[model samples]
Target: MHAIEVCNLKKSYTQGENALDSISFHIPQGAIFGFLGPNGSGKTTTVRILNGILSPTQGSALVYGQKVTANSQEIHRLCGVMTETAASYENLTGWENLDFFGQMHGLSKTEIKNQSEQLLYSLDLYESKDKKVKAYSTGMKKRISLARALLHRPKILFLDEPTSGLDPESAQNVTQMVQKLAIEHGVTVFLCTHQLKYAEDICTLYGFIHKGNMLGFGTFQQLLQEKNSTIYLELRGDSIPPSFTPYQNANKIYKIPITGDTDASQILQGILKQGGQVYEAKQIHWGLEDLYFAYQRGVSHEISTKSNDL
Candidate 1:
């Protein structure tokens, strides 16, 4: 089922200016959809429209096939949103903030207690649950906001930079929890993040926006094809076969184009038989980072060519 459907959505604050151009896409249920873009590219505006916090200048967004508007209440109930500025009560303890929001979501006292404890533990805040939020670090605040968002077991999650200030271990916990929510509990996730390496691990689908325009939207393989991406075997060793090319500006690193993992594995075995000390070897992933820049660069070239024509 399509969890969210956005069609010809546009938002403009000035008479002839647009914050969001007419962009359209749909995210399936239980899928982790990566909504990626640079700052001020209308990513936040689109999120606000879908969350019913802002009204669109034209067109609509439907959540679970129910239309969302600035006045809609039902859509808010189904979504768990954690943004960079998700506010918490500074006077309240970490646990208190969760308890307050959980009650607002209509969770009973017992449900709140059980869920809060579990979340606190999972986010590594159990030991400091009683600490006042004012005294907590920036990362702690982010974690608490995340816990509050999930306290009601929301079916749709909108997370912007979920690991903004987290330590490596804490970020991993958020990653695992996000995966668990999508895979085990069937929650649809709309993720906006600058961390491409992190998003590459969990995102099941992707959408790229630039200058308020949605330049690309599809699954991993589809985007790869869109970018005409190629996979290369990256081998690091003191010596390598003459067939491989030295990687750009990197010593002892060689790159050889290959079809897929099977091809890369076959070539690696053949290299091993030649007895060179292979320090590291793996197929270089044409990951989100690569695809993102490729899309941006394509758009830049198109604009440049049009300008030259004009």
Candidate 2:
């Protein structure tokens, strides 16, 4: 079953300008769906709508086939959200804050205490459990916020830039925790972030958005295929074959962009026949960054061509 679904989901402010255009997508259960875009691209807006923090201007979002607007209370019970700027009481200790939220979620006092201690230990914040939130570092506060979000043991998690200001070690820890939650607990994670590399690491599928429109949506392999981008090869050889053109590279190595896997075998045979010895040959796959730029470039080119045609 789809964990989250958005169809023609549009949101606008009083200015009548849409933050989320008629966007649509489905996040399968147990999948980490990466909502990727630059600042002001409507990523946060869409997340807010899904969480029922903000109402959609038109259309709707559904959680487990339940309309977000119609069943917001139930949706809230089933989802955990951790935003970058999570609000917490500065006067309260880390453990205290967690206990407070636990109670709000209807956990008994004993349950709250036990869960709070466990979360603090897991997040490596046990030492700072007694420390007031105001005394904690940015990373500490972020971790505490995450712990609070998970206190209720929600089935789905909405994480918006969850590791925005965390140190490398802390970020790694958080990423691992997120992966564990999804894999071990079957928690569906909806991650919204501008960190393409990080997103690539944790996300099972991706939805690329720009200017309030979803440019593409699929797994990494699917996106690569949709772009029809070439798989480049780096070879340390002399006297290249006639079929292969010089691609991007430097010293002692040459690169070639192959349109298909079959082309690589033919190129290899041609090189061998020409008495050229290849030291290293491997397919170079395009990453999320490359695909994102390609999408932007394609959009720009389309606009330019249309303008010229007009």
Report clash pairs, candidate 2. Answer: none
Candidate 1 structure, TM-score to reference = 0.83
Clash counts for all predictions: 0, 0
Question: Which tens-of-lDDT digit does each residue in 1-310 have in candidate 2?
Answer: 7999999998878586888889999998889999888888988888788878789988879999888888787888889889875677889999889888888888899888888888889899999999999999998989999998898888899898889899998999999999999999989999988898899889999998887889889998888788886666557766665455445367647667666567778877888898777777776667777777677566311110101100
Candidate 2's displacement at residue 143, Å, is: 0.4
TM-score of each: 0.83, 0.90
216: Cα error in model 1, Å: 1.1
What is the alpha-carbon lDDT for the whole of candidate 1?
A: 0.84
Q: How many backbone clashes does candidate 2 have?
A: 0
Score each candidate by Cα lDDT. Answer: 0.84, 0.82
Which parts of model 1 have CA positions greater than 4 angstroms off? 233-285, 299-310
